[model samples]
Target: MVETLKSWRKRWLSCGDTENLFRDNPSNQMQGVMQLKATNSGMPMKVAQRIDVSKFMSYIKVSRTQLNHIKRLKQSGDGIQTKHVSRVIGGLDKSHVKPYGALLEDEQRRLREHWLEMSCNDLPAAFEVLRERKVLMEKSIKLLGLELQQKNVSVLRKVRCDLSFNSFS
Candidate 1:
């Protein structure tokens, strides 16, 4: 199941304030967030007793304000369901659904093998393929140049014939 900020806070906060440090950073802020390893260190609290009421009150006030705001926005709606919006919407939107079926194990293996074969696994062979492609490209370019030259010559011949004929006239 996906973890949300409220759930995460509940989970870690339930463990006690001594074990976790919630910061203002995005990963620790409102909404569902993953448990941060840095903040959620299982090590014994070094400054548990040092926590002042002012600091605790500030956190509580901030959380209460956010909760109230969200409740107002949601107004009469269920408060923050754990399921994603797409899941809640059900099959009405097929956009999230996969277009194709999952591949069979044998087909997946075959594709992997084909990809390995196509990849530059053998350097010498890959270089040879590149060289062949370069040669073919050069040959095609030369052929195109020859064809262009022939067309130019034909056009020049026609122009010369027209000039001569017009001169005689």
Candidate 2:
């Protein structure tokens, strides 16, 4: 219907659409967040709250409550990277100051301020898994070839033995 098309377009064009079509769509929300974050000033509370809800679109989605937790490290103070907000934290914190580092707990983290800015959302986890699978498949194929060769050799030996015995007979 014409109404459906209009609603769809509104959702695509602006985050403030009244129909709320994008409320459940995380990707769209992520985009809205990015746009809002890029403004010269901080985003209005309404926009920040909408982007926060997007944190739930996927299993890894980060909720609005947790947004500020990571903000401590961001230089721009815009928002967390989309992928980093996933269900799990998934890795060591990017900070260089470890527990053994000479810096105090608070001071150590500040040391990583620059690195945190560099840490925004991006993921290679899934690709790394696929890479491992490819390696395993290659190894399996090689072993299968060796087994086939051994079987062929054994069969040839049996045939040769039979041929010599039949000749004598």
Candidate 3:
């Protein structure tokens, strides 16, 4: 019985070339490879990947005020919901069913107008503006769950930068 158990254990533990296991299953194989790489490097498992919000905003032409509203929402300890965040940041103007959609749409229109009028010569500054806008959008999404309308208004009152920077240098 002892010898039989030992033999079974060795067979189960052996890392042999099992072509059918991974080769036949693409997703499983990729997962196996990722697990192997992660373990070998002693890296912590990454729960979420970093999104390049700037690139996404540029593609969608999301406005700065819209971004600021999102940020204010997030900072007030409102948990960001993925659906609303996606809608606001990605330019999918879905009816939110909540009262906030009308207010958000009004602000978004102003931002669109602002973007149309602005021109920047400095690439880095322009990139920063885009980056900041993305940050605000992300934060706003985070805030959506935490604050009431009055709280949202108070939180948003503070983010009063022009967003239009004329670089002297």
Per-residue lDDT over 44-64 for candidate 1, one digit per residue giving the tens place of the 0 to 100 score:
776654235323432111235
Question: Of the pair 1 and 2, which is ahead by TM-score?
Answer: 1
Per-model TM-score, in order, reads 0.31, 0.29, 0.22
TM-score, prediction 3 = 0.22
RMSD of each: 21.3, 21.0, 28.3
Runs of candidate 3 exceeding 4 Å displacement: 1-59, 83-169
Worst 10 residues of 1 by lDDT: 53-62
Which rank order by TM-score, best down to worst?
Answer: 1, 2, 3
Model 2, which residues run further than 4 Å from truth? 1-122
Error of 1 at 108 (Å): 21
Q: For candidate 2, write residues 1-169 as lDDT tens digits.
A: 3544676687677766566655688996676567655662554554456446544432323345655655653555765675654422434343232332222435567767755655542235556788999999999999999999999999999999999999999
Which candidate do you rate higher for lDDT, 1 or 3?
3
* lDDT of each residue in 63-169, candidate 3, tens digit only: 68768867876786867777667756653454233334445577799888777656444566788999999999989977875667668776666443322232332
Task: Supply candidate 3's per-residue lDDT for 10.
Answer: 73
